[model samples]
Target: MKGIVQLNIVQFSLIYLLLLIILYIMKRSKINQTKLLIVASLRMTVQLVLAGLILTYIFKNPHPIFVIIYLIAMIAFSIRRVLSKNKGINRNFKIALSFSLAISGLFVLSYFVMAVVQVNIFNPQYTIPLAGMIIGNAMTGVTLGMKTFMESIKTQRNKIEALLNLGVTPKKILLPYVNNALETALLPTMNNMLGMGIISLPGMMTGQILSGTLPTTAIMYQIAIMIAICTSVCLTVFSSLHFGYMTLYNKRNQIML
Candidate 1:
């Protein structure tokens, strides 16, 4: 098979013209996202370009320290983004969110890299991109779970208080909400999995195929990564909600939120 064809500047720039169609549609529909669309497109372009540069350098000068630093940065940024979306959470809740995301993400990523891929953990070419995918998905899952859990608690405050008065344990009362939140968090990943071959081609598989990997090999990696993502997401969301709900009640067993 031939090597992947590289797109030159002109060819790549032409893709931006497609964004004009989106902008036009948004404007005609009176959607207030024109500025957001433009800013997001520009930011994505800049970030990916910078990432390419950094990745090129890292790939050339691979070191354990560089890999460690990159992983830390990814986890830290993921935690920050999750926390930023969840305003007014307590310190303990913040810790839970950060801990779950970092721990679960790293654990799954480490296993996927060292166990499944059988590569040195410090191998930047594989570790960095895989970590980004795992950590990014975990962050998204935890965010959605947190949002759903918080909203459920707030909306069902009266029911919770009633349950508490009826001598129900906090764990028993809050378990359902946690379960619901987890289900909500897992749905997108599950749905994506359901539609894998029929509805859409996943990005990782497409990239590997484009880079001249065998279709069978790419399919295997895609399947493994998808499972890893789902597991990471499940662990992170469950941990966050499991530990997070405890923060909602105190020693008196009264509903705090």
Candidate 2:
């Protein structure tokens, strides 16, 4: 099989022309997202290019310290992004969010690298890319779960107060919201899994196939990664919600948030 073909600079630049279609649609729809789209596109391009350069250097150097530092940076950025989206959380909730993302993400990552892939966890090529995918998905999951849970609590504030007056435990009152949030968080990943290899080709498998990997091998890897991603998402969201909801009440069983 032939190796993957690299696109020249001109060929790659041509792809930017596709953005014109989105711009035209926004104009016709009278939407004001043109500036936002342009900014997002530019940011994505610059970030990916910078990441590519950094990864190249790390791959060549191949040190345990590089991998550890990279993973730390990724987790920190992910936690910050999640928290930034969720303003006004209490200190305990913030701690829960941080620990949940870091612990669940690292646990799944370590297991995937050491047990499933059977590679040195310090191998930047495998660990870094896989860590990005795993942690990114976990971040998204936690964000969605937290958003849904918080919104539900806000909207049902009266119902919660009524329940509390009726002697209902906070756990009984909040458990449903937690469950709903978790299900909402898992839906996207579960739906994507349902349609894999049929409705669409996922990025990792497609990239591997293009790089001349055996189709069967790529399929196995894709399946394994998807399972890992789902597990990471579940564990992170579960830990965050379970630990976080406790903070909403005090020792007197009074609702705080």
Instruction: Give the best candidate by lDDT.
Output: 2
Give the Cα-based TM-score of candidate 1 against the true structure.
0.95
Error of 2 at 35 (Å): 1.5
Could you give the C-alpha RMSD of every candidate to the true structure, in order shown? 1.4, 1.2
Residue 8 of model 2 has an lDDT of 98
Per-prediction tally of clashes: 0, 0
> What TM-score should be assigned to candidate 2?
0.96
Query: Candidate 1, residue 35: CA error in Å?
Result: 2.4
Q: Where does candidate 1 clash, by residue pair?
A: none
Clashing pairs in 2: none
Best by TM-score: 2
Query: Over the stretch 1-257, how does candidate 2's per-residue lDDT look in tens digits?
Result: 78999999999999999999999999999999899999999999999999999999998888999999999999999999999998889999999999999999999999999999999999998999999999999999999999999999999999999999999999899999999999999999999999999999999999999999999999999999999999999999999999999999987789987
Off by over 4 Å in 1: 27-32
The per-residue C-alpha lDDT of model 2 at residue 20 equals 98
- Of candidate 2, the 10-residue stretch with the lowest lDDT total is 248-257
Model 1: per-residue Cα lDDT at residue 142: 92
Superposition error at 186 for model 2 (Å): 1.0
